[model samples]
Target: MPAPTDYLLTHGGHRVEVTYKNVKNLRLRVLLGGRVVVSVPLGVPEHELRRFLDENHAWILRAQQRMRMAAPPQEQLVDGGRVQLWGAWRELVVADGDRASAREVDGRIIVTGADEEARARGIDALYRRELMARIPALREVWEERVGRRAAGLRLRRMTSRWGSCNTRTAMITLNTALAKRDPAALEYVLVHELVHLHERGHGPRFVAWMDALIPDWRARRLAMRGTP
Candidate 1:
């Protein structure tokens, strides 16, 4: 058996440490601070751990990059910068006019108001509008895939969880972060929440039903979780 510290790594922003124990599986996990650490059975060779990390190098880097980018300065909102809606780029334009509202015009989103401060408010308003525009399509897709009806769908600026469902009320609340992923992933999440109307928890039945509907849902779920 290799020494317990043989797999230690502090490269880049990720610090990984390894421990040997009596375990059935060689498990690798990224902690909340973006540190990836692994534990393996005592007899496993160090080469095996190295091979596993190398195989998953892409995922590790992608996770770290996402953690780094998620803390962007909110005050930097400006014109011509790309804001993602369903993982597609939407360019921003600031306009000074009588209309104190933001709108998506001519393939670009236009934020207009009498005061310069309205630009920031207008940008937030436009994000809400885009989300509203997507609700009907989301409901339709969910109905087809999950074979259930959602009484209502709401959007929120949630810090955790991409979406949630209230089976009692047949309502789903989706995190505004959905706007940051691809359209397909958004739809997948919508269907997922809608499915909760029929199945409450992510038990075996739910997994089977989800797999039945979206064959590549696991990949889409990983993509939304910021795994490249």
Candidate 2:
């Protein structure tokens, strides 16, 4: 296999990292931290790459802006720190103990462990457990409304998408991060993916079904995107 070539391209005072790879198409990605990356076929000339970047300058700028706006504020995950859960802010309480455990008490999340890392892991475990407990009930409700049943459900940490559906297998994989969001937002994602079971694309019929099934879906989506 050939190695990818990396270079930098500057246009109109903006710069983007360009990589030439063994691929058939040109792809542009604006990452979460406002970094711009363009991947092109190995044989593409520098002039062509520059032209492509030039043409898509506005799009790159808008994508970077949106990413910057949507990025969540970083958390230190220490005692007295706060985290968002179910669309609401909750205080984190850390206690000293040999065995790690996490639970919610009086609107605060209490984590006990030997150190910070243990406490963090304890909290993550709590998040996964809570998601597992909530998904079954939510799935049951949406299945009744959509008149379709999912064959399986899975959870994982995802950077870009909230959920995806495998229409072929009738499975839905949800982002574990949803546990930190509003329960209603999670429902919206569940419905959106389940709708994909009936209609694969976001066509008119799909939109119609969503409208009929979850009328306030657009609002929930906007909330997910952190839009006002």
Candidate 3:
């Protein structure tokens, strides 16, 4: 492990602390906040790091601007953090015991617990149910538009890609995180995955097909990656 380096960065009215991690291939990355951070190999010269930053200067600035512009919710969805569901904001209630179930009661989604762990699980379960219900409707819409049949659909909590398709099996796997974003993004992801049924790799033909179907596919793609 490398010792941490802290740097100050400003984004609109907020100040963020950035920490750099030294790993292989050594690259610069920024989290959601407008933080300037860089990582390099153990023996890389300072001059090389400067060159890398120069080459990526435009990207860094754009990322910072977008992060600053995207308004963050006043409250988080963590334990005791009031969360908005559907159209109303409600207190995140936690209950103890195994029987604690998450369901909408009087326009509020309730969980049972005292800390982050219990509240997170219940909140996740609630989102998972919503995703499950949406999948079938999404599949129907895309199937009609694409005129192709998929082998199946499965939902899983994935850390990497939003969704993936097995062309051979015709089955699609969607990320659980999609449940938190807008419904249109979910539709876009579904279409992207299902299009894999025809084109295994993303080539000119794939782009053409996607462009024909969703004119703003590129914008939608960028939005999914949390880019502006």
Candidate that would win on lDDT: 2
Candidate number achieving the greatest TM-score relative to the actual structure: 2
For model 1, how does the per-residue alpha-carbon lDDT over 65-88 read when each residue is reduced to its tens digit? 455345442333455444565565
lDDT score of model 2?
0.82
lDDT of 3 by residue, 1-228 (tens): 554455554433334344445667656676665566666566665566566766777887667645644545544544334554433455554555554356667655677645556666677677778888888887888888877778988877787888999988898988876766777778888999888887989999889889988989998777667511
True lDDT of residue 159, candidate 2: 80
Q: Which stretches of candidate 1 lie over 4 Å from their true place?
A: 1-75, 97-100, 113-120, 226-228
The deviation in Å at residue 93 for candidate 3 is 2.8
List pairs with backbone clashes in candidate 1.
86-181
Question: Arrange candidates by lDDT, highest first: which order?
Answer: 2, 1, 3
| Residue 132 alpha-carbon offset, candidate 2, angstroms | 2.5
Model 2 residue 188 CA deviation (Å) reads 0.4
TM-score of each: 0.58, 0.63, 0.59
Per-model clash counts, in order, read 1, 0, 4
| TM-score preference between candidates 1 and 3, better one | 3
State candidate 2's TM-score.
Answer: 0.63
